[model samples]
Target chain A: MKLVRIFFKAVTMELSRRMAYKADFIIRCFILVINSIISPIFALILYTTTPGIPGWKFEEFILFQGTLIFVFGFTHAFFWQLLSFTIYEVRKGSFDRFLLLPYKPLSYLTASSIETDGFSEMFTGIIIIWWAFKKLGLSIFSANFILYIYLVFLALVFHYSLNIITASFSLIFIRSWALMDILSSLVIFAKYPASIYHIGMVFFFTFIFPIAISAHYPVQALLSAVSYKLILFLTLSVSLFFYLSISLWNFGLKKYKSAGG
Target chain B: MKKYRELTKIGAKIALAYKFDFIVSIFTVPISIIVFYFLWKTIYAYSGLDVIRGYTFEEMVNYFIMSMVIALLGWSNIERVVEYDVLYGEMVLRLLSPVTYLASLFYTEMGLKAMSLLVEATPIFLIGIVFFKAKVFSILNLILYAIAVLFSIGLVFLISFLIGLSSFWLKRISGISRSKKLFLSFLGGGFVPLTFFPKIFQQISEWLPFQYIRYVPINIYLGKYSTFLALEMIGRQIIWIILLYIIAKILWNRAIRKFCGVGV
Candidate 1:
């Protein structure tokens, strides 16, 4: 309870700081939302030129893009600053301050910072998902809302895990930002359908990196494409990723020798 | 000119020191190409048509690969650096430097761009030609393309310089810079060729200077526009260059005045 309270307080503090600059925050939100709007436009162009990507129609694909934008925007809002600060502090010797804190360093690192611009993603996502559902002749608020929300939660964890794993590399390297950027950029593949890529890529993103769970798989589950086996697979895979991520961070912590110490 | 030459050499060496960043920048070409290759492959395979928007499968792939190559060549860390400089009062160093700030920046960008061409762009350019087997252009077309490539790089730098200059007043430019990048990339046809866009969109893109930044040069190499159209393309590019150069100079003057007024 105390730990949760710490996180809550950090989030509130971050939000108030962001809200301190009203115009700046509003413009950032607008820009982020506009940037996200481009992906759907990309989808629109492809669909117009072609019918769509094989089995997927343009409308159906909007949900996939929407899910992706929402997932990435949310993950990035929190962890972009988190990992960036982790690296900055590590480099500048400010990390010692965190070490001095009574609470765990990992918790403090994860919970303290938030970006309000990310909320724009959720709003845009809702708009896209609703419009896409309407165009596809499906109910917007189906009984699967809870299931979809739960799957989104799983994807969120997966995203957080991926971020931490890349961030852990900064412990040893003088600069790992490029590596993190490359890894994050590779998620562009997951925005499209799984069937479009080769068989090997499908397996890699699904079972190995499991980026598809963030958007593609969740959309599939929402579309009733799988049986109970999907849930089982998701639970197992999410657990495995979360475990590996934590292990990686601990390994980095062990390797860390404070820069300015 | 002597000072600019010295700064350029220093900039190249400084850029080369970060070898990992160079490698990643080069790697982005293949990674992006692969993803888009799969995407268009699906699009083409599903459409069951030979030509959509006048781009064959090979041409479409080659176009994107070329755009990525061009974009990689033009990449500069100037905007982010400028934002930080304004934020933390690092602009004072530039202000105090004996060399003119914009001249120093231009020299550094040229050095880095030259390094990218030698170390990153040329190898990838050759590999793309061999691997993608795009339409072979005539020697004269290649010469024309070479001219446009220089101007395109200049255009990108000027646009970024203008955005950086805005940091003087805005103070925090993350949002403005982000918006600028999106506009540049989209209108520059970094993702898809402008020809593939809806007619209205293509028109709008043509009106903007961004299309002249990449689309004009890449399409020239692809042998899409020729004769009068090619001349017109290059003509518009040079015109926009002059226009933006004037705009950038005006803004630089005002921004510097504002900086002095505020005394950062």
Candidate 2:
């Protein structure tokens, strides 16, 4: 609860700082919104040209893309700055400042760093999801909606864990920004329907890495196509992943011999 | 030219210094190819068609590979560099240098891309050849492709330099650069082939200089155009390059005046 309050306060401060550069902020957000919509737009173009990823209609695919974008936007807004700043500070041997702070280093770092463009991406995702739901005649007040929300929450947890794990690498490697690109390559597999990938990839995305938790299963929950067994497994896996990430952060922190300036 | 050559060497050395980062980045291209391969493979199988929009599954994969190549070749971050220098007052230091600013940037970018060609693009091209049997090795096609790519590099540099020049007026050009990048990738057929675009977009793209950036070069490599037609496309690229060079010069003179007037 305290951490959440800190996160909100930091977010408010960051928002005000961004608003100080009104033109730049607005233009950056507008560009980000456009960037966020590219995947959905690509899906639309594909669907119009040919049958896109079997067993999925245009609107369904749009929803899946929207869900991925929303999850990405959420992570980008709240956690991505933590990863980059960790790398930057570690590289400059200035990361010990976090340790000197009153709060837990990871929690405080995560709370403080916020990106303004992410809100625009999140807004674009919401618009896309709403448009798709309208086109599909789906209601937002159903049991499925509750399940979708739960899964999306898990997805957020999954991304937060991933960010922590990646940021922890910076403590050890000192220049680990390239690790984020690998995460991007892995996470992109979830941008489309899992049916399009090989069965092995689908299994890997669901159980092992579980990037599909960010989009695929959440969309399935909304479509009422998800299985209880998969949800049970996702819940366990995401919990384990989060545990691993925190454990890794502790390990990296212990291993840290600060590059003292 | 001698100073520019020295600058290029320095740029290449800087890229080499980031070799570890480049190695990790190499993983990205293959993963992108894998995703495109599976997605298109499923699309073709479900549609029960051998070809859609003049692309077989193999051809489509090859198109993506060539698109990646063209993208690497044409990539420029001069706008961002310019933005930084302008906003941070580093432009004054760069102005003390002997070589022209944009020329120095162009050569440096070329050197960076040249090294990346060896580190990144070559391996991806090889993967296309070995795995997808991408037939992009015809002599005539290769010649035209090289010429077109040269023009593409110039065209991209001028466009980015012009965007950077706008910083003198706007004070910040990150949004412009980002928008230009996203728009170029989409409209230049980097994301999808122009053949798959709607009729109106296809017609609109024909008139845009962007198509020459990725689409025309890749298509020439794919032998989608005859030798005469490929040469004609290269001619169009040269015209765009010349026109853009003119515009960039005009913009640069005005931007310098603005900078001087403001005492920046």
Candidate 3:
């Protein structure tokens, strides 16, 4: 309870600091809205040019894209600072302050930075998802929909694990920012159906990287036919990725030079 | 002229010192290429051998590969410098220099990126041409394509300049800069061909300036337009460049005045 209170206090302080920059914050929110609007325009172009991209209809693609934007907004809202934690802290030699704190470094790092712009994208994403669902003729209240939501939670864990793994690399290399950018761009692939690729590559995405699980599998579970084995594989992959990321993070922390100390 | 050349040489040397960054950026090209390859490949598979948006599967792949290369070559890191100067108050020192800060920074950064482009493109070009059996243009076409590419680079530089200059007003412009880059990639046909866009979008994109940087050059290289049409397109690009350049200058003057007034 005390730890939770401390985390909340840190989060509140960060939010207040973010709020102080009102103009910049509002501009960023507008940028996010523009970004959300533009993504669907591209997807619309694709859908119009080609009938359907293998295993995904026009509405299905919209759902995938909308869900992706939605989930990304959620992650960015809560943990956007994780993306820059290493670079900011290392440059300021403030990372040592995190180490000095009683709480886990990851939790502290996450709590200390919040981007309110993400809330704008998250709001837009929810609207897009609802529109996509209506277009696709999916039953929103079905028992199967609940199972799909569960899988989405699993996928979020897997997605967060990939980010944690990559961010952990910051301890060894200061230039991990560029690598993170590349990785984030690669995540765009998950916004489409995995069946578009070869089965081997799909397997690679699901197991090796887990991006397929991020959007492809859960959406498939919700709207298309999927096997129990695939679900089990996805759950196992999420657990394995989370474990590896945590272990790698611990390993990287030991090698951290921490700018000053 | 001599001073600019010397500064360019120095910039190239500094870029060479960061060999790892140069190498890692090369990896970025293949990732984009593979993603588009799969995307268009999927489209082709579903549609069968019919041409969509005037591009066959193979042709679309070639177009995107070239677009990716051109976009990489035309890439600008001016925002980093802008953010640095704005946050650290280094703009004051830069303002004191005899040279126009934007022009000097532009030439130096462009020269550095041009040199890095050669290093990055050599391997990709070789593999793309020799292994992939990608189509090559005639010698004259290649030269014309090079001119178009230089124009595209100028257009991108101006855009980046505007984004960077906005930092004078906004404390943090990275999000805005990123959003602009993303917008360009989608709307400018960096991710997919602009030809595939709806007619309304296609017409709109033609006027947007972003399309001139990526789509116009690549389309010209792909022989999508005749020589007369290509020249007209290049003229349009030049117009956008001049317009953006003027806007950037006005913004710079006002932003600096504000900065001086506030003493931030």
Candidate 4:
């Protein structure tokens, strides 16, 4: 309950800050919207030349991209920004300020910052998903809706796990944020259906990397309708990746070398 | 000129000290190439089309590889340097140090870029040539690409300097920096080839200056343009350089006058 209260307090503080910079926020959010537009348009253009990614229709691919944007919105707005702050503080030898906190550092590290600009992506994602849904002839009342929502959340968690794993490396390696930044850009690879990838790629994304849960698997479930069997696989992969990430995070914390006070 | 050379030497030395980080950063290049490679392969396979927008699959991949490499060459954190120094009045130290601040900062940034080129770019290119059999440019085209690349880097620096000057007014320029980067990527065709863009976007981007930074140079290397066209593109790049350089000079003066030395 205390940690929950702290998390909410952090969120409230971020909300207040967002309001204080309303003009700047609007400009950035608008720019981000403009930037994200290129991807879906690129997808559309690729589809124009060919059927696009083997089994995927243009709408289905849009759905995939939308789901990715949605998941990225959450990570971009919440987890990733805080991780960046942690990197900066660590490098400046000022991270001891956080380590001195009464509460667990991870709680503050993960939630204290918010990137309101990503709300633009969320809006864009909603539109894309809505369009995709209309094109695919799905509705809120569809049984697959519940499963799709569940899987999308699972994907978000998986993405969060990836960020945690990346952030954890900061404990051992100085300036590891560069590596994390590179890994983050790899999200572009997941925007299209995995069906287009080689068999090895599909397997790698499914298990080894597990970014598929974020966009690819969710779209697959929505289009094909979910089955209990597929949920089992999804649950397994998400759980494994999440569990590993948490373990690494804990190990990194123990390995961490404190900087100047 | 001697002072500038000394400052550049210091910049290059500082960059060399972080040699490992520079080398490690380039791993992203290969990762990007692989991802784009797969994406295009799937697109081509699904379309069952050899040429889309007048690009063969090989040419498309080669285009991206070259574009990304060019981008890495042109990349500089002019905003971070200018913003931090201008806001913190760290520029005062440069003034006291008896060196041209602009020359010193540019040298430092270029030093990092040059290191990246040697450590990250050249090797990737060599490997790409053997592995991807990346675009075989004519000698004339290669010479033209070299010229284009020089102008492109200069133009990119000017544009970035102009953006960086905004920090004098807006202390928190995270939004501006992000906006600038995204706009540059979109306009420069970093995300996708301009050829693949809808005709309207292509037309609009052509009116803008970013295409010279990545698209034009890569095209010259891929031999996508005629000698005449290559010359024309390179000419545009030179024009942008002159145009942006003038704008940057004006902005820099105003930004300095407006500076309040908030942190200092």
Clashing pairs in 3: none
lDDT of 1 by residue, B1-264 (tens): 788899899889977886677777666667777788888898888789899888888888888877877877877657777878877777788888998777888898888888888878887777677766655567777777878888888888888888788767666667777777667878788888888788998877767888888888888887888757877888888899889989988887787776753333
Runs of candidate 2 with Cα error greater than 4 angstroms are A1-5, B261-264
What lDDT score belongs to each candidate, Candidate 1 first?
0.79, 0.85, 0.76, 0.77
lDDT of 3 by residue, B1-264 (tens): 877887688778887876666667566667667776777787788788668878877778777777777766877778868877887888888888777888789768866776767887666666567645567665555666778888888888888888888777777776777687777677778877887777897888766888887787777877878888888888988888899999988898888777752323
lDDT of 4 at A225: 69
Report DockQ per prediction, comma-separated. Answer: 0.64, 0.69, 0.50, 0.51
Ranking by TM-score: 2, 1, 4, 3
- For candidate 1, the TM-score of chain A alone versus the native chain A is 0.90
lDDT, candidate 2, A1-261, per-residue tens: 888898888889988877775676778888898888788889979999998888888999999988888889999898988988888888888888999988999989987889877888888899999999999999988989989999999999999999899888878777776887887777778767888888998898888888888888898889866788889999999999999999999998997878832
For candidate 4, give the lDDT of residue B114: 70
CAPRI grade of model 1: medium
Q: After superposition, how far is residue A107 of candidate 2 from its true place, in Å?
A: 1.1
Q: Give the interface RMSD values of the models in order.
A: 1.6, 1.4, 2.3, 2.5
- Model 4: per-residue Cα lDDT at residue B36: 80
Tell me which residue pairs clash in candidate 2: none
Candidate 3, fnat value? Answer: 0.56
Candidate 4: clashing pairs of residues? none
Interface RMSD of 4: 2.5
